[model samples]
Target: MWGGDRLDNYVEQLRKERGLNQEEFAKAIRVSRQTVSAIENGKYNPSLDLAFIISDFFGKTIEEIFIYKGGADK
Candidate 1:
């Protein structure tokens, strides 16, 4: 297992910037609100496929949306 959360994302910020709440953003990305919440709270590390989906939804690159700190950034 991993030591801690090493992945973080700006999903909440980006969603808010677009004026979309969790539910709306989840709909846009074809995810559940719980999934969006989990990602925003740093409790989940999405698979590569989901990462790409998020990047595509935001018109951003995977690296732009997901930050890999090498270790727990919490």
Candidate 2:
């Protein structure tokens, strides 16, 4: 479920840090701008493949970008 409210990401921050807009970042990651927007807004959970792609594009690990805040529930 991508944790809904429990999921957090640094996509927007990283994209801005790299001076790339949503469209540019989406293109770099081979995804639609809307998809990027969804991920940035925390309304969508990326597939494992997409996660790898994004992480690779930013030279980071999936855990570095997507954080699960529901760990406290366990």
Candidate 3:
């Protein structure tokens, strides 16, 4: 059951843990709040550059934020 949580759920968890509202997090990541909402709702997969920016902002690796459900080998 690894990497099973929905993207929205994971983002919500991270937002709460980091004490960031959508507007604040979006500002930090230089995206619109609606964009953050879309990402949190699993409606979008950010570009690699944006992904890296987000991971760096949170001090986490991309793998930590975006899970690969089928395992590393896919």
lDDT of 2 by residue, 8-68 (tens): 9999999999999999999888889999999999999898899899999999999999998
lDDT of 3 by residue, 1-74 (tens): 22223432266578879999999999988899998887777777677798798888878888888765543434
Clashing pairs in 1: none
Model 1 CA lDDT for position 45:
76
lDDT of 1: 0.84
lDDT for model 2 comes to 0.90
Alpha-carbon deviation at 20 in model 3, angstroms: 0.9
lDDT of each: 0.84, 0.90, 0.75
Query: For candidate 3, what's the RMSD?
Result: 5.2
**Which 10-residue window of candidate 1 scores lowest in summed lDDT?**
1-10
- The worst-scoring run of ten residues by lDDT in candidate 2 lies at 65-74
**Model 1 residue 42 lDDT?**
86
Task: Quote model 3's TM-score.
Answer: 0.77
Model 2 residue 11 lDDT score? 92
Which pairs of residues collide in model 2?
none
Model 3 clash number? 0
C-alpha TM-scores of all predictions:
0.87, 0.88, 0.77
